[model samples]
Target: MPSSASAPSRARSARPGYRAVLRAPHAGRTFGAALLGRLSYGVVPLALLLAVRDATGSYSAAGAAMALFGLASVLLSPVRAALVDRHGPRRALPPMAVLYSALLLAVAAATARPGTAPAALAALVVAAGACTPPLGPVMRTLWRRLLPDPDLLRRAYSLDGVAEELLFVSGPLLVGLLLPLVGPAGAVVAGAALLLTGALLLVASPLAAPHPRGGDREERQAGADGAAGGGRGRRAGRLGGGRALRSAVLAAAVTGLALGALDLMVVAFAEQQGRPEAVGWVLAALSVGSAVGGLGLGALDRPLPNAVRLPLFTAGLGVALAAAGLAPNLLLLGAAVALAGLFVSPALTTSYLVADEAVAPDARTRAGAWVNTAVNAGSATGGATVGLLVGHLPLPLCFALAAAPALAAVPALRTRDFGGARSRRKSDPAPDPAP
Candidate 1:
C-alpha cells in the first residue's frame, strides 16, 4: 500500500471528476448523436401544428393534434425505455426510428391532402408520436452507466440540460428558416430526416451499444416488470424504488403541465400577431436564458443541492410566466419567456438527476422515461388547453392556466421522501487552516 503522504493524491485522482467523466469511454460520441436526434423534438410539434393549420385552417384542430401527439408519446415512453434498458439501443432505436419516420411521413401526406378530416389528422399525429424513438431516455440513462461518481454524474446532467436548451433553440430556428421556403409540410419532412439520421448515428455510437450480456440482462428485464408492482415489489429487490420514484415522477408531471401551456401561448402570441415565423426567434430567446442557467449550474464546483433547488426553480418559472402574460409586444414577450425559461432546463436537469438517484441502476431508463412521460402528458394538457382558449378568451389570461399548475408543483416538492441523499450537505468544518 502507498504511504499516507501519497494517499491524498491518489484519492483526488481517483475522483474521476467532471472532465474525466466526459472523456470516459464513448460519452462524447453518444451524447453528440443524441443531441442531433433531439433537435427534431423542437421541430415536429410546431411543424405539425403549422401543417395542420395550413391544411385544416383551424388552430383548434392543430392544438388537438398536438395534444394527441404528446399523449401518445407519454404513454409509450416508459415501455420503449424498458426495452432499451433490457435489449440496448442498437436493437431498440433503429426500429423505433424507422417506424416513427414512416408515421411522420404519413402525417405529412395527410397534411398534403386537402380534405383529410380533422379527426383523421389528429389520429395520424397520435400514431406518429407513439413511434417517437426512445433515444432521449436512452441517452440520459447513459450518464449513469458512464459515470458512477456522484459529482461527475451531476455535472454531466447539467451539461445535458444545457445541450437540450440548445436543441430547442436551434431546432425551432431551423424550422423558421425553412417555413417561408418549404411551407409547413416541408418542415415536417425536414424534421423527420434529421431525426432519422440522428437516430442511426446514436445507435452506431459504441457508447449506446449493448454491453456484454452476462447474467445482467435477465435481472434488468425483471426490474422492468416489477417497477410498478406496488408494496410487495418494494421489498423484492432493486426493481422498485418505492416512494421516491413516485414523488419525482409526480414533480415531473406538474412541471411538464406548466411548460406545455407556455409552449402553446408562445406559439399563439406570434400567430395572433400575424408573424408566425417569429415563433422560432422568440423561443430561441427563452432557450438562450435556459442554456445560460444550465451552463452556470454545471460549471459550479459544488452545485446547489438539487433537492432544495428543484422547487425553487419551478416556482421561479411560474413567476416568469406570469410576467410573460402581461407582455404587450414581441420584444417584451420574448424577454419574459426567456426569463421563465431560465428556470426550465435547470428544473428538468434536477428531475433527471433525482430520477437517477431515486431508482435502481437497472431501471434508470424507465425512470427517465417517467420524467419524459410527465413532460409529454403536461404538453398534451397545455396544448389542448391553449388550443381551446385561443379564440374564446383574451390570450393573456390563458397564461394563468400555465402558471397555476407550476405554482402547484411547489407543494409536490415538499415531499421529504427521496431516499439515498442527505437532506443537507456536510459542512467542511472550517477547511483546516493553512499552516
Candidate 2:
C-alpha cells in the first residue's frame, strides 16, 4: 500500500532550538532578505554622499542630498507602514520595492552624471527613500505571527534588535571595502542591487502572505469575548487614540541621540590620534558588544516587562556613556564604548516591546513605523548638533550632552501611562465561555 510521502520525511528533518526559528519554513529567506534590506540602507547614505561629491565636487551638495534622503524616509515611514497593516506584503512590498529600487538607480545615474542638476539629485534621493519597503515594521509583525508563545516572541524581538545592529556595523564596512575597488558609482550600483535582491526575497517568503483584516481566529474570538479588541470604547482613550505610543517612541529617540553622540566622539578621537583608519575597528567593537548583550537577553527564559525594566535600562545606558567620555586615553575610551554598547540594543528592544503592547494588533505596523521614525530623527538631530559642537566644546563635554537625553528619558518613561488599554478591559462584562 502506498503511504503519504512527505509527512514522515519532513518530521524527521525538522530542526530545534532558538536558531530553529530561522529554520522554520521560509524563515531563512524572509530573515535574510530583511537583513540585507536593512544593510543596503546602511550603505546608501555614506555611499551616496561620496558618489554625489565625486561627480559634483561639492561636499555641500552631497550633504544636502543625503539629508533629503533621511528626511523623506522618516516622514514617509508611517504612511507606508499603514499600507502594510491594511493590505499586507503581497499587496504592498513589490510595488514599493520596485519604486524604491528604481529611484536608487536614478540617484545613482544622477550621481554619475557630472552636470546633473543639484535639485534633481535631491528630488531623486528623497523619492527613493520614501518607499524603502517598510521592511523593519513588517518584519516585526511577522515575528509575532511566527512565534505564538509569549517567551519565544520576546526572544524573537531581541534577536531582531541584534540583527539591526549587525546591519549598522556591516553596511558601512561593505561600502568602504567596495569603494576602493569599484569607485563611488559602482559602490552605489552594488547597494541598489542588494536592495532589489532583498526585496524580492522578502516578497517571496511565506510569512509575506496576507492575513484577514483584523487578524486570525483567536484574535476575532478575543474581540468577541470583550477583550480590548471588542471594548474599543474603553481602550479608546489610552491606546485608543495612540497616546501610549509616545513614551515608547520617546525612549527610542533618546537612545538614538546617545548613539549618535557616541559615533561622533569615536570619529573625533580617531582624528585626534592620527589614526583615522582605526575608526572602523573602534565602531566594530561597539557593535560586537551590543550583539552579545542582545543575544544573551534573547536566549533567556525569564524576562522583565518593558515598563518595569525600561527606565532602569535607559538610566544604565546613560551612566555608561557619560563615563565613557571620562576615559583617560584612546585605548580606555574604546573599552568604555564597548562596555556602554551593552545596554544599547536591550533598551531599544524593551522600548519596542512596550510600543507593541500599547497598540492594537491591527495598528502595530504603523506604530512600529512611528517609533522607527523617532529613532532616525533623534539620531540625525544629534549628529548635526555634534558637527556644530565638536570644534567648540571639550570632547568629554560633548559626550556628556549625548548622555543627558537618555538620563532624562528615564523619568519620562516611568511617568508615561502605557498598558492602560489592556487594563481598561478588565471591568467589562464577561462574555459567554467558549464550548
Candidate 3:
C-alpha cells in the first residue's frame, strides 16, 4: 500500500492510456450519441406530421398534433432532466426511450382508424413528447464526466454544437427520404425503431455510466472548502431555485423571440421575389455557417470566459441578422443569414455551459430544459412578431426587430460570481465538478 501522495503519482502513471481514451474513445461516444439524438429529432417531426396529415386529411390537424408534441416536450423536459439528475442517465434513458417508441407506434396504429385517428394522434404525440429521451442534456453531463480537461470539454461541446446544427439540417432531409419509401406510416414506425435503438445504445455506453463515488465525494469536499474560502462560492450555491428559474426564463424568452423572427424573415425574403425555393437554400446556408463556427471552435486550443464569449457572440448575431435583413439580393441575404447563424450555435452552447456552471447539480437538467423551452418560446414570439411586422414595417426593420433579444442579452452579461472559479482553477483541465 503506497502513501496517498504516491497513489496519485501511481494514478498519474496510468493517465496516458486514459487520456488516449478521453481524446478519442470518449469523444466518439459523445459524438455518436449526439448524432443519433439529432437523427431521431430530425426524423420524428416529419413522420409525425405525415402520419397526422394522412390520418386526419388536414394539414391543420397535423400542425396541431405537432404543437401538442412540442408542448409535451417542453412540459416533460424538466421532468426528464430531474430523473437524470437523481438516478443518472443509464437508469432514466432506456425506459423513456421505450415509452416514446411505443407512443410513436401507437400514433401509427391510430392513423389506420378513421374515427379515432385525430384524438389518438394528439394523445400519442403528447405521450411521445412526454417520454422523449433527452439525449443532449444527458450526454452533456456525461461529457463532463468522461472528459475532465477544459480544452477537451470545450471541443466536446463544440462538436455537440456542430452535431446539433447537422441534425436540424439533415433530420428533415432524412425524413423526406424515408417518407417516400415507408409511406408515412412506415416512416413513423421506422423513426420509433430508430429512436429506440439510439437511446438504448446511448444508455449502455460506458461514458454514460454514473460517476464513481470517490469522485463525487472529492467534489463535495472541494465545494465545502471553496464555500468557506470566499463570497463567490456562497453566491454560486445561492443561484438555485427562483434566481436560476428567472435567468432560464429570460434566456428562453430571448431565444424564442430571435428564432421566430428568423423563421419569418426567411419566409418573407423567399416570397419577396417569388422564389419560394430560396427559403430552403437560405436555411441551409444558416445551418452551414453555424456548423462551420462549431467546427472552428472545436479545433481551438484556448478557451474564452463564457461571460465574455457569450455577450460578444450575441452582439455578433444581432449584427448578422440586421445585415441579412438589409441585404439587397437573395445571395447577399443568404450570406448574411449564414453569418448570423454561425454565432447562434456557439452562443447557445456557451449559454448552456454557463447555466451548467451556475446551477446546482440537482437542478441542472431542469435548468437545461428551461433553456430549451425558452428557445422554443422565443422562436414562436419571433415568428408572430415578424409576421405582423412584415406587412407593416420594412423588411430591414423586421430584421432589426428580430435582433432585439440578442441585443438585450448584452446588458444581461454582467459577471456574477457563480462559484465555478473555485473548483475550476485555470490550471485544471476540466469543468468544476458536477455542478
Give TM-scores for every candidate, taking all chains together and pairing residue i with residue i: 0.77, 0.87, 0.85
2 versus 3: better TM-score goes to: 2
Which sections of candidate 1 miss by over 4 Å? 1-21, 52-63, 109-123, 179-183, 213-215, 218-239, 263-283, 320-336, 383-401, 415-435
Q: lDDT for each of the candidates?
A: 0.76, 0.76, 0.70
Ranking by TM-score: 2, 3, 1
Best TM-score among the predictions, by candidate number: 2
- Candidate 2 local lDDT, residue 41: 80
Alpha-carbon lDDT of model 2: 0.76
* Candidate 2 RMSD to the correct structure: 6.4
lDDT (Cα, tens digit) per residue for candidate 2, span 1-435: 235687777665552346766766677778888888778888887888998888788999998888888888898998998787667777788889889888888878777768788888888888887877778888887886777555666677888899888887678889999998987777778888887788788878888876556444334233234435445543311223244577778888988888877888889978887888877778777888788878777776565656666787788888988898898777888888888878888878777766766655556677788888888888888888888999799888988888999898877788545544352243222357699
All models, RMSD in angstroms: 7.1, 6.4, 6.8
TM-score for candidate 1:
0.77
